[model samples]
Target chain A: MLHTLPELVNQRTTLVRRGRFLCVDFRLSVGDVDYDITVNHGRLVGFTSDGGLLRSWRFRIAAPAQTWLAFWQPVPAPGYHDIFALNKSRLARLEGDLYPFMSNLRYFKEVIAIPRDFNFTTEQDLVA
Target chain B: MSASLEPIVGRYLRTTWQQRPVRIYFEEAGNGIPLVCLHTAGCDTSQFRHLMTDPAVTDRFRVIAFDLPWHGKSPPPVGWQDEDYALSTDAYTEIIRTFCRDLELVKPVVMGCSMGGRIVLNLAAHHANEFAALIGLEAADHQTPWYDTEWLNRPDVHGGEVCAGLISGLVAPQSPDEARWETLWQYLQSGPGVFKGDLHFYRADSDYRDRTALIDTAVCPLYLMTGEYDFSCTVEDTTRTGAAIDGAEVVIMGELGHFPMSENPVKFRQYILPVLDEIEKKSAPKS
Candidate 1:
């Protein structure tokens, strides 16, 4: 099963359990910025946010049974040159100066572990 | 029974070490080797909707067209990154390789249009022996100046709008009816940023010239076609682009533009049928 940081500060957070899925909600300091990430059996099944924004990114991680998924918005917009200067001095400065601030932004991970035997009702259930 | 569009469940075929997402669409018929059909950039497998439903194409080859992450039904990669650079190309190439390996597709004929055309070129160049043949229609060459500029990134630029305009112009029932415009508009809305991201990736790419050279040297039979008014890749440019390749065949269809398949289906079929026939003949067992 996958997991996220236990606590998120600078943002209002809520975790609600709906049947077998866990829905984690986040309302960012920036008004109108909110997102809900859904997890099932420790894997990320889907994510929904304002309009088409998060939906686009969510599709990238919704694959492979045991794979881990994470999402975050980079800080200071990483100037245009950073794209071409990844191996140069600009990247070093950006990594040291800006990365830590954005570290707490938001993220998700898919852990590798099968549900206990008790979680299974039958072979058909397991297949389902 | 004939094949239907019901979603088929399958594993994520990792194309590169990075493991990009590749969804495979399967057809029930066909006994010969599978054919990989790569769709244009803006549209997904839907671009080949007509071809997929046609008995001629499907009965002859088990055609498969995958959603490149950030386009069509596929999701965009986590975070915003340049979509046109070598990184994006590498990721896409990996997706194709992985899809073929996981699905056990052997000697598949890789055909693509526009961005899909660029992809087929990359595949043939990097993994020459993986595909049986390569065909590019109005394919964007790497050396083209598409990357060095960002024409679509303007604040007012909306890909959905551009797509709607292009579709309205290309498709018949030629009235500027609101319903048709709205239909195209709705289709464009599903993945706006993804299209923008792909455009960014295209502009950032710097290896088209090198890859084009590699495709020429790979010694694979290459077929290239472009419409009369294809602004993306002119016939002159495409001819010069594939000049280095020993046996690369080139055809320029008249009275057509960027999308000959959509603009002139009859002529498009006339040109492509002979090629398909040739592929089927060669792929047949030797007596």
Candidate 2:
């Protein structure tokens, strides 16, 4: 069970390869906690929990923990289906340089979706 | 079990009403009467990729779509940074005029969605002489109150993500996963602030409530079809707009959304085919 997004990205080689040309950096804000991630030459080179905001990053996608839980499901519901859907409904926020985020949208979307394959569990839905 | 036919993709350079050099990207497929398609705002000509390839549609119509000046493969006009890139009625109408004239599409059937939908009505009102008919998908006279543009333009807000999020809501609730995802992907790939720029026209600049009277359907047939899930341009809203225009046809598409043409092309085609058939029958040579 992959517990964190950083760990999930590092393990997904194919996903990383799919985004090799996306030599940009972005952050994912899960609830109040922020994870700084970097994709360099199609490799997941940096995945760290930053204490402060990484202002230099191309974009920062922030959503509530509950929103992310629904989104990461193998099959997501209406509001959780797409990151932009969340933004439309005011459930999530995307801030910073939008060009890189828009231009390389598919690469980042797949990269974020990698964790869905991992059977991770939180206290809310832990089977064990 | 589908036959594949590729569209001829090309670029056209034109000096738009904005007096800037703009490269408009376009795609064309099939033959027969010309049918020029306009993409939703913030998206490019690629939204019609599947429609252009559909043999059923292509056999009787020459389908064409073009990227607006700043959307898709077409970059912003020179000195774009100096002025805010809000899509005005004049600029929007002029681009369409120049595009059709440049291509020599005699009496083409014009179709559009969302922002494109709104503009086609304007095209009918002012330039009815140019087109044979007008098809407006998700067309409305005013923007819904739910569309909040302030936060979307904030400096810290990621324009792309929020744009995708907001626009994704308009996709039909039952749209195919691939089709829905592909529609959202267009918003994700749009140029920075392009969606917002387009919305400036969609939300505030493009109200046709009073002006709808000017749309003479006899001059150019008017048809408005809105998706059931298009909360922004709900069926009621579209019907209200259609009621204002004389001889305008109105339709409500079940299981479709604001981005119906792209979100579910098959369903959209089903709705559109009958309308096209009617147009062809009416326009057929009177023996």
- Model 2, residue B251: distance off in Å is 1.0
Across residues B1-287, which tens digit of lDDT does each residue of candidate 2 receive?
99974566565656555676677878788898888989998889888888888888899889989888889877888788876678888788888888898889999999998889999988988889888889998888775656456645557656776677667657765799999989988887777778778888887788877688888898989899998767677778898898888799999998788887789988988898899998887778899
lDDT of 2: 0.78
List the DockQ of the predictions in order. Answer: 0.01, 0.08
* C-alpha lDDT of residue A2 in model 2: 23
Residue B205 in candidate 1, Cα distance off native in Å: 1.3
Q: In order, what are the TM-scores of chain A for the candidates?
A: 0.20, 0.80
Window of ten residues with lowest summed lDDT in model 2 chain B: B143-152
After superposing candidate 2, which stretches have Cα over 4 Å from the reference?
A1-128, B1-5
Q: With candidate 2 superimposed using the best TM-score fit, by how many Å does residue B186's alpha carbon deviate from the native? A: 0.7
Q: Is the docking of candidate 2 incorrect, acceptable, medium or high quality?
A: incorrect
For residues B1-287, could you state the per-residue lDDT of candidate 1 as single tens digits? 99786332222333334643334433233445577767555556555544555577667877676766655555555543655322367666767777677778888888887666777777777787777778888765653442222322334444454444333323222212443344354335635554445444455652476666677434556788876555455567678766755677787766555565554555577778777787788677899
- Report RMSD for candidate 2: 6.7
